[model samples]
Target chain A: MKELRWGLLAAGTIAAEFAAGVDESKHGVLEAVAARSGDRAAEFASRFEVPKCYGSYEDLLADPDVDAVYISTPHPLHGAWAIRAAEAGKHILCEKPLTVSVSEAEKVIEAARANDVFLMEAFMYRLHPQIRRLAELISSGAIGEVRAVDVAFSYNFATPRLTDPALGGGGIFDVGCYCTSLARLVSQAATGQDVVEPEEVLGMARLDENGVDEVAFGLLRLPGGVLAQLACGFQLTQDDHIRVYGSQGQLYVPKPAWIHEMRKPKTSQIILTPEGGEPEVIEVEATQGLFAREADHVAAHLADRQAPELTWAETLANLRTLERWRAAVAR
Target chain B: MKELRWGLLAAGTIAAEFAAGVDESKHGVLEAVAARSGDRAAEFASRFEVPKCYGSYEDLLADPDVDAVYISTPHPLHGAWAIRAAEAGKHILCEKPLTVSVSEAEKVIEAARANDVFLMEAFMYRLHPQIRRLAELISSGAIGEVRAVDVAFSYNFATPRLTDPALGGGGIFDVGCYCTSLARLVSQAATGQDVVEPEEVLGMARLDENGVDEVAFGLLRLPGGVLAQLACGFQLTQDDHIRVYGSQGQLYVPKPAWIHEMRKPKTSQIILTPEGGEPEVIEVEATQGLFAREADHVAAHLADRQAPELTWAETLANLRTLERWRAAVAR
Candidate 1:
C-alpha cells in the first residue's frame, strides 16, 4: 500500500515509457529524473512532470527522496549503472538484456546483494496481467499439458542501431532476449518445475557490420522434452505475439508480447480451443501496470526482507542460457 | 507434351487424393492400381477407372505400362517402395518426409538416379499455385529483402494411425516436416542460395508411448543469419499457416501452410507493405486442388526428361535438416 519513490536514469524513449507507467501507477511515484546532461535531464523531467532532475546519475541516486533507481541505459551500461545505483543505497530496476554479457550481470547481482538493496530486471511483459493469467490457464490444464511454445519479438530497427555495435544494438540483445526470457518464464510456470537450462542451444544470428546480432533464432529444450522456438530481429517488420500450445487449448498474447511493453487496459487475451471445440478468447486485466507488479512484488519482498518473486538463481539460469547463445553465435 | 502414365500406389486417404488429381489432369492418367490384396486393388482400380489392378507391390512394379509410381505408403516403408519402384524403371512421387531418415533417403535417391528416372519427394503444398506465386513474389523482391520466416503445422493426430511409431507416428515427421521444409525452402528462395544447414539445431518434442516425437519444434539458422522458427505437433491440435516477413512487405500463404495440404480457393494473399508505405493484399484464387500444380509440375518434368521442379539435391538438403532435428530429439 506504500508508494515506492522512484528515480529515473537516462532520458530515452524506454525511460519515458517506464516513467509514464510510474505516473499512471497507484503504488509508485516518479521522485526524480537524471541524464548525463542537465539540459536533457531537465527536459525529460518537464515532459514527465517528475519532482526533480539531476545532471548526473550519482546526483539522482543520492537524492534522499528517491527509494529506487530504474536503469534504462543501453545493454553495456546496465551493469555499471545498476552497480552504481545499488552502491548509492537505492533499490534498482534495470532494463532487459540486463547486461550485454553474463559477467556483467554477475557484477550487477553482486552489487545488489552486497548492498542489501532490491534489484529486479524490468521484464514488464511477464508481470502483465495477461501473462500471469496465461500461466494460470496453462497450470490449470486449460490447454492440456504444455507441449510447445512459440515466442517472437521483432521490429524494424535497421537504421543506426544496425551499424553501431557499441550500443549492444542487435536482435539477440534487443529482442531475442525477450523471447528467451519469456520461454523460460512460461516453461517454468507450465511444468511446475523450474525450467531447466536448455541441454543444447543452437543459435543463428545475422551479424551487422558492427558485429552485433541483427536477428537471431534459437531452440531451447526443457526437462519434459518441451521445445520453445524463439525468433527475434531488429531488421524485420513484425507483429509481436507469443503463443503457448498445450494439450487442451492454446493461449495467444495479442500484443506487448514482452513484460515491459504494457498496453492500455493492461491485459491480453487467452485463446483456448478445447478438443472438438471452437476457439475462445478471454481478456485479462491486471490490477497494476506490468512494470508496477514487479515493483510492488519487489516492495513486498523488501517489506518482508525476502527475495523477489524471480530469485537470484532464476536470474543466473536465464543469464547462463543467454551467455551460451551469445557464445554460440560468437564462435 | 508427353502424357505421364501414373500408377496409384495405395487406396488410402492420400492415395485417393492423388487419384483425384490424376483423374482431373490433362497430362496424367491412372494407368495402374496396387494394394496388398487383389480385391482392394480391384476396388481402387474400379474407383479410379485405372486399366490395371495388381494384388502385390512386385506385380505393380512389373507392369511395364506404368510410366511412374506414386508411393503413398507409411513413412517407414517409403524408402523400400521408392527404391523398388525406381528399380522397376519407373519415375517416383513419394509422400513427404521423403524417407524416415536421411540415410534411407540417400538409398532412394541412388536408386532413382541409377534408373535415370524422374524422382520427387511429393511435398504438394509447395506446388500450390498460391505458394508458387508467394515464392515468386519473395524472389522478385516484392517483399523487399526477406528477413524472417515463421511456419506452423499442427494437428491433433493422436489418432490410431498417428499413435503407431511404425507409421512414423508423431508431429515432427507427420506434420513438423512440412514446417521445417517450408522454412528451408522460403529461406533458400529469399536468400538466392542453397539453404545452409543450421549451425546448431535446437528442438523440443512430446514423446509418445512408443518413444517417438509426438509434438515438436525446431529453430534453424541459414546463411546471412536468416532465422526460421517452426512449430509442429500431433497433440496440441491442428493449424496450418506460413508467414514470410521481409523488409518491404510480408507475404502470407494463409492456405496450405504445410506441404500437400489443399489451400481453399481465393484465401491466399500476399500483403505488400513497402517501407514508409501502407500494406497491399493481393488475393490469388486456388488454381485447382493442391495436388494439381504438383501433378502438372511432375508431368512437365517428365515431359522435359528433367529432374522434378524440387530436385533431388533440394530434397537431400531438406532430409538432412530433418535428420539432425530427429537425431537431436532421438538422442
Candidate 2:
C-alpha cells in the first residue's frame, strides 16, 4: 500500500479538520503543517503529531517528505499557493471555489498538468457516500426525470474571509459553489452524462455594507430543462437541505453543504418520496470520516492525477458557474 | 346565533369538499347545489342532503334563502358567477386565483361591495390554525429577523383545471398563487403590516404544449430585503415544504399549499430550528376540517363583509402578484 504524505497549508479550521481526518485515513499521513502564523502552525503541528512545521507555505511545499499538499488558505491565496505547490512537485488537494475566476482556475489546472501532479478540488461533501447514493437514485429513475433541484447552504457567520470582496469572500464564492456543483452533478446523473453545463444562469444578491453579497440566489437551467435553484448567505441562517424534484417523486438530502468529514461519524438520511406514495428514508451510515474518505479517494487516483468522480473539467466548470452566478447577481 | 345558508356552485371536487365541510360548520348549512351538469348537481345535492338542486347557476343564485355562495368553478368562471351571486344578495366565498385576470377579480370585488354582500377568497390554508400560529410566530420574532421565505406547491396531478390554459390552467394560477400569497403573508407578518406587496417579482417557467406553465419559479423581493422564492409545478412533484429562513433561525412547515379542509385531519408540525440549537416542533391539532374552520371564520365576519384573515384587498393583491409572476416568466 502506498502512503501519501500530506502537507497542510494554512492552519485554518478546515485544515485542522483535514489533518484530524487524515490521521484516520487508510493510505494518507499528515507529514507537515504550515501557515503564515508560526504560533498557529506550531499549535496545529503539535496537536496533530506532525514531524515538520513551517512558518510559510513555500517551506511546506518544498519539503521532500510531503507527497501532497492540502491548500486551505483564504480564497485569494488558494490559486497562487496551489500553483506554487504544483511547481514544487507536490500533488494538490485545493479547497473549493477552486479559484476566484475561471482564468485563475484554468491557470491552476494548467500548472498542475505542466508539473504532472495530482490535482483535486476539495469538495468533501461530494466524496461522501450519501452523495453517491443520491446520484445512484437519480440515475436509477427512482425520482423519475429530474425537473428541479433546490439547495440552500447558508449561515449567519460574518467571517472576514466571507465578507470581503478583495479576499474573494461572498455567498457565491464561500458557499454557493457547493450548490452549483451539486446541482450540475444531479443534472449529469439524471442525463447519464459525466458532467452538464447550465444553458442559462440567473442570479440575485443582497450586498452587505462592504459591497460583498451577504445573501444570494441563483437559478441554473441545465440542458434538458432541469432547473437548479441555489440560495446561500453570509448574513442569514437557512435550512441547508438539498431537494430534487422530479416527475414521479422527490428526494431530500439534509445538511449536505459542508460536512466536516471528522465529525464523529453519524448516520445521514436521504428521503425519497414517490408521487402519491409514502416516504422512504434511505439511511447512509458511513464508516469513515468525510475528509478521510476524500483523502483516500484522492490517494487512490493520485496515479491518474485526477479523480474520476470529480475531474479537472468538472472542477473548473463549477468554478466558472459560481463566478458567473456571482457576476450575474450584480448585473 | 345567526345561521348562514350556503349554496354550492359548480359542484366540482372542491365544491363537494366545501359542502361536506359546511355540514360540520357551527353556523353554516348547505342549502342548495348547482352545476352546469344537472346530473352532478342532483347527485351532489342528494349526497350532501341539500334541500334544493338547480341545473343552472342562475337558478341557484335566485334561491332567496341562500345567504352565501361558495363558488368552486374553474378559474375562468369565478368572476362572472361571483358577480351574479353578489347581485343576487349572497355573500361570496370565491375559490383561489380569484379570477384569471386582475380586472376580473376587481370586478368581482366591486360587485360584492356594491351589493353590500360579504366576500372572501377561500384560501383555506390561510384560515387554518396552523397558519395563524405561523403568523404569530413570525410576528413574535421567534426566528429573529425574517430574511427569506422559500415555498413549493406542486404535485404531478394533471387535472383539466390545472393543465388546460383555456380553463385558466397553469402552475401559477392552479398552485403557484398559494406560494405568492404565503410569501407575501410572511413578509407582511415580519414587517408588521396588513399586507406587503413584493418590491420586485422575477419569474421563469417551463411551459407545456398547451401554452401553460407546467413548472415555474418566481422570486419576490419584498420590503426590507426579504426574498421569497417560490417553485410550483403541474408537471412535477416537489417537497412542497414552506421554509422561513431568518437571521437567527429557520422554520419549516410541511404540505402547506393545498390542504383539503375535509380530509381526515391529523396533527401537523411546524419545525423551528434556532441557529446552533436543537429543533423544537410545534404541533397543530385541529378540531374542525379546514373548510369548516374557514366557513366559521367567514360566518363570524359576515357582519364585517370581509374576512379579516384573508381580506378582499389581500386577495386582489395576491392575484396581481401571481399574474405578474406568470407574465414575467414569458418576458
Candidate 3:
C-alpha cells in the first residue's frame, strides 16, 4: 500500500499540528513543509523530521513527491493557497473555515472542480468517531425526532496572537466556527436535510480594540422547525461541547470539540443520559481507532476515484452557513 | 407591618406554586383566588386557604381585600387582566414574560404608571440570590471585565400546550424568552448599564405546526463589545443555566432558569472558575428570596410611593428586544 504523501503550506502552529496528524496517520506521511523564509521552513522540517522544505507555498506544491497539500495559513491566505494547490492537481485538505469569506470559499470550490482535484475541508472533529456515533444515534432516532441543537466553543484567547486582526484572529473564526459547524452538523443530521439558513439573523458581538470580533454568538433556524443556539468566542471559556435534543431523550457530548495530540492520545467518551436514566459514559476509541479509520477511508476513496464520506456539497453548505453568520455579525 | 394582601388570577400549576411561595413568605399572604369557573376558583382558594374567590378576572379585581393581583393566566389574557387590575387600583405581579406582544407589554406599563400601581414582571428568577450574587461578582471584577454571556432554557414541550399557537404558546415565547431575558440581565449587570439592548439582531427560529416558535435562538451585542448567545425552546431539553465570562475568571450559575419551585426552592450557586484555578461555589443568601423579595419590594414601593426595585423602563427595553426578535423571526 502506497502511503499518501503530505505537504504543508505553512509552518505555523496549525500547520505543525496538521503535519503531526498526518505523520501520525498510518496511511499518510508528512513529506514536506513550506514557510515564507527558507530558514523557517528548514527549522520546521527538521523539528517534524520531514525530508523536504520549501521557502514558499508555490515551491512546495511543485514537489512531485507531494500527493496532497494542506493549506494551514492565516485567514487572508487560505483561498489563494487552496486555489493554487488545486491548480497544481494535488488533493487538498484545507483547514476550516475554508476561507476568509464565502465568495473566497466559492472560488476555492471552483478551482478544485476546475482542476479535478479531491478537496475537503479539514473539520477534523467531523472525522472523529464520537461525532459519527452521535450522528448514528440521532439518525436512528435514539432521541426520537431531534428538536434543537446547542453548541459552544469558547476559550480565553487574550494572547496577543488572537488579539491581532491580521492573524485572521478573534473568537469567531478561531473558535466560534466550531460551535457554528457543530450546530449545523447536528441540525442537518437531525432533520435529514441540509441546514436551512435562518431567514433573518440577529447577532451580538463584542469587539476588541482591533475591531475583530472577540466573542461572537449566533442562532440558526433549520428546516422542520428546529432551532440551534450557538456561541463561540476567543474571549470566554467554554466546555467545547455539543448537545442535541430530540422528542425522546437528549444526547450530550461533553468536550467533544478537540484536536487530539499526535502522541499520548486517549479515547474520548460520549455521555448519554436518557430522561429517566443515569448518565452512561460510552468510551469512544476515536483517536487511535478512528483517525486511522478516517485516513483509510480517505485513501480508499482517493484510490477508487470516489468522493470521501463527507461530500463537497455538505462542505459547501457548511461554509455558506458560516459565511451568513459572519455577514450577520459584520453588520 | 400589614400583610401583603395578594390575589391570583388562575388556578394552574404556576398559581398553586406561587400561592405556596407567598404563604411561605414571612411578610406576605395570599388573600384571593380566581379562575375561569367559580368552582375551580373556590377549590383553589380552599386548597391555598385564601379568603376570597372570583369566577371572573373582573370579579377578582373588584375584591377590596385584594391589594395586588398576580396575572397567571394564558399569554393572550395577560394584557387585558393586567390593564383591568391596574384600573381597579390594584398593583400587579405578572408572569416572567410581561405580555404576549410588545404592544401589550407597553399597555401594561402605561396602565401601571397611569394608575400609580406598583407593577413588575413576575420574573421571579431575577430576585434569586444566586443571580444577585452573580451580578455582584461581575460588578466586583471577579471575572475581570465581563465579555460574554450564554444562557439556555429548553425542555421537551413537544406535547399539546406549547405547540398550540392559539394558546400563545411556542418555545421562544414560553421559555426562549427566559434565555433572552437572562442574557439581557447578565449583560446589563456585567456592563454596569441600567439597560442593555443588542445593537444588531440576528435570530433563527424553528416554527411549530401552529406557526409559533418551537425553538428560538439568537445573539445580542451590547456596548463595550459584549456578546450574548441565548436559546429557549419547547422542543429540546437542556439544563436551565447561565454562564458569564470575563478577562480574569468565569461565573456560572448552574440551573438558573427554572429554580422557581415555590416549596423546594433551591438557591442558585455562583461558581467562579478562574484559569488554572479550582472552581469555588459562592453561596449567597438574599435579604429576601425571589417571589418574596419581589413581593416585598412591590409592597414597600406602593406603601411609600416609591419605585419598585425593577422599573417599567426595563420592561419596555425588554419588550423592544422581544419585538426585534419577533420581527427577525418573522422575516
Summarize candidate 1's per-residue lDDT along A1-331 as a digit string, tens digits: 7778999999898888788878766678899999999999999999989989999998898888999888988778888899898889898888877787778888888988888898777766665667777778877778777777777887775656445778777777777877877788777777787545776776767676657777777778765556777777777776677778776767677674463345344545677777678888787766666555555665666653334446666667777888887776674
lDDT of 1 at A271: 77
lDDT (C-alpha, whole model) for all candidates: 0.76, 0.86, 0.74
TM-score of each: 0.90, 0.93, 0.90
Considering the two chains of model 3, state its CAPRI-style docking category. Answer: medium
RMSD of each: 3.2, 2.5, 3.1
Residue B305 CA displacement from its true place in model 2, Å: 2.7
Model 1 misplaced regions, further than 4 Å = A1-3, A158-163, A194-196, A257-267, A286-301, A305-308, B1-4, B100-116, B159-170, B191-204, B207-211, B223-225, B257-267, B275-278
Off by over 4 Å in 3: A86-89, A101-117, A158-167, A191-203, A209-211, A260-263, A287-298, A304-307, B158-166, B257-261, B265-267, B286-289, B305-307
CAPRI verdict on model 1?
Answer: medium
User: Model 1: what TM-score?
Assistant: 0.90
Provide DockQ values for all models, in the order shown: 0.60, 0.53, 0.64
lDDT of 2: 0.86
lDDT score of residue A131 within candidate 2: 88
Error of 2 at B194 (Å): 0.8
Count: clashes, candidate 2: 2
